[model samples]
Target: MRRQTQECKEYMEAGEKYLDCQDRQLTSVMQDWPKDINHLLLARNKIQVLRDNMFSQFTQLKSLDLQQNDISMVEDGAFSGLSQLTTLLLQHNRLKTASEEVLLPLPRLTYLRLYDNPWSCQCSLDSLVRSLQLPSNRNLGNYAKCAEPLLVVGQKLKKLSVDSLCRDDNQVDRGTGGGDGGRPRLPLIKVKPEATSMCHTYVFPKLLLDCSNKDLDHIPSDLPSDIVKMDLSSNIVKHLRPKQFLLSKDLKLLNLSGNSLRHIDTAAFAGLLYLRELDLSNNSLHYFQYGVLEDLYFLRKLSLGNNPWVCDYNIHYLIYWLKHHPGVSYTGLMCSEPQEFRGWRVEDYVKTYNGECPKDRQTGGMDTGQGGQGGSDNEAQEVAGETGEQLPRPLREKKRNRFEIIRLS
Candidate 1:
C-alpha cells in the first residue's frame, strides 16, 4: 500500500494526471507526495500539517489552490521550489505566517491572496510584509489586518508592518509589549510619485498624488506647473490661498479628499484653463462657496459630497452651478441641509443674484487687480460659508474605521 501511494505521487510528478485530493482530511502529507503535479487543488480539505519539503519538487507548479483548509502551521521552506508559481490562493486557512526564506524562491510570483486567515501580524511574519515593500514586487499588499489593540486597529488586511506587526523569535528585543503590539514608528509608504509612477502607467493621463499625511498643513507652494492631475487627499490643510495653487496650464483632475480645509479662496484656481474633474470628497468643509468653482468654465465634475453645507443666502449658488454643468458624476452623493434646499441642484442659488456673483470684490484691491480667489469677474459673489467657525475633524490619524463619506449636509 505504501509503495502504491509513493508510485501515485511520483507518477503525477512525471507530467501525469493529478490526484483528486479535495476534502481528503489529510492530517499529515508526505514530503515527496507529488513532485510533478503542475496544478494542485487541495481546497475544502482537512489538511492540517504541511512539511517543509512538501512542495520542494514541483518546480513548475503555476497555480496552487489550498483554500478552506484546517491548516494551522506551515513549515519553513514549504514552497521553496515554486519558482514559476504566479498565483497562490491560501484563503480561508488557519496558517499564521509564511517565512521570508520560504517566499524568497518565488521569483516570478505576482498575485498572492491570503485573506480570511488567522494572521498574527508579528515580526515573524515580516518576511511576507517585507516581500511586498520591494519595488519589483507588484500587487502584493492584500488583506493584512493589524490584529487588535495595535498601531493599525482593524481587520480588512490593508497593510501589516513587516518589522512591527510580527515577532522576532530569532532576535531579542528589550521593548515591552506583545506581538502586533507597540506603535509602529514608520511613515506611510509612498511607493511612487503621482505622475511618473510605473503603477500610473495605465492611468497616466489621469494620475492621483498623495501629498496627504506628508505632514503638510498647507498646500505646497511648488506644485507641478503643468500637471494634468493631482491627488492631495488625507492631509491637514486649514484654508486655501491664491498663491497656493500656482496653477498649471493643463491641470484637469484634482483630488482634495480627506483634508481639514474649512475655507477655500475662490480665486485660488485661476490659471486652471483646462480644469475638468475635481474631487473634494471626505472633507471638513462646513461652508460651500460656488465662486471656488466659478472660473472653471469647462469644469464637468465637482464632488461636494460629504460636507455640512448650511443653506444660507448664497447656498443657492451651488444649485445654479449644478443646473448649468451637466454630465457630472457624483459618487453616491447626497445633500444634508435645509429641508427645502435638500437635494437641490447647483443652479438653485441663481434666484438671489441675477447671474452676477455676490462676492465682496473690494477686498482684492491690495492684491492683483483681478482679486484673490472669487476675484475673476465683476459678477462674482462673496464666499457663502467663511464664518471663522472651524468644525471638529471627523477623521482620526490612521483611524480608517470611521465613515469617510463626504456629503452635502
Candidate 2:
C-alpha cells in the first residue's frame, strides 16, 4: 500500500525550532511529533474537524497557525492542554459556531485571528459573543460577522447584543453577569492612595480615569482595574518601563499625548492585549526600538502626529509594521530629520531606501574611465552606509530534508 502518513519532523527559523506542515492535503495531524514544539504551522490543509485533546501533548506550544483550512467544528477539549498558547490563527475557515469553553484552555491568548469565517449569530452563539464583548477582551474577535439569521446577518459578532440573539429575555439578562450570573466578575481592587489623589475617576457614560496634566513624571501605582479608559496626556513622563500597564488589562483607550516621551521599553505595553486606541501625538519620539510594538496585537487607531520622526532604516520598522496591519489607522508620519528627506512622507522615503544603483556604475569593470576598477564596491559601500545596514539574505528558501537508513553488513 502507498504511504499516506509521514513522520512529524522539525523545521528551523532564526535558530528556533518549529513544525511546518503547510500546503499538505492531509486530514489530521501526523503522530510522533516532539512534545516540546513551541510553534506549529498547519496552514493550507484539508483538516476539517478538531477532535478532543488533539494537541494535548504539545504542552509547551506558544503559537498555532491553522489558517486557510476547511475546519468547521472544534470539539470543546480539542485544545484542552495548550495553557501556554498566546497566538492562535483560525481565520479563513468554515467555523459557523463556537463556544467560550473552546477557548478556556487558552488563558494567555494575546493574538487571535477569527476573521473571514462564516459565523452563525443565533441563541447558541450568545455565550461566545458575550465573552468577546467584555472590556478585557476587546482585542479578541475582530472583523467576525454573522452569516446566518437574516435579522442579524452581516452584523459584527462583537457588537451583537446577547438579548437579541436569544428568545428568552430573562436568560439573556442573567448572562450579562448580574448577581448569581454564570459569568465570573473581575475582582475589585482598592484604588491606591496615589491614584485616587491624582486622578479624577468618572464612572457614568463609561468608566474614565482622567490623570492628564497631573504634572507628574511617573505613572501612579495600582491603577483601577475596572477603568475602561485613561487620560494621561500633557505630562512630563519621558520614559516607559517594561510592563508598565500589566495590571490595566481592561483598558480599551489610553491617551499619552503631549508628553515628553522619548524612549519606550519593548515590553512597556505587555499584558494589555485588549488596548485598541492609543494616542502618542506631540511627543519627542524619533524612532521606536525593534519589537517595541510587539505586544499591541489588537491596536486599531494610533495618533502619532507632531512627533519628530527621523528618516532612516531605524524608522522603517514602524512603517513596515503599519503596512502589514492595514486595519490600524495612523496619522502624522512625515520625516523631520536628515534635512535632504525632510517634508517627505515616510512611505515614500522607505521606497527609495531599496533603490538600486545606476547600470553604468555596475558595468565599469574593464573601462579605464573615471568610474573604473573599484567603483562598484565604493558605491555599494556608500549605499550600505546610507541605509545603516547590509542587504538581507533570503531566509525562506525551501530545502528538501535528507534521510539515511542503515542496516548491519
- Report residue 173 deviation for candidate 1 (angstroms): 16
Tens-place lDDT per residue, model 2, 79-118, is: 9899999878787789999998999999998767676677
lDDT per residue as tens, model 1, 96-131: 666667667677777665555666666666666677
Pairs of residues clashing in candidate 2: none
TM-score of structure candidate 1: 0.37
Query: What TM-score does each of the candidates earn?
Result: 0.37, 0.43
Instruction: Give model 1 RMSD, 1 decimal.
Output: 18.0
lDDT of 2 at 303: 93
Off by over 4 Å in 1: 1-19, 28-35, 149-151, 155-158, 161-163, 166-409
Candidate 2, poorest ten consecutive residues by summed lDDT: 400-409
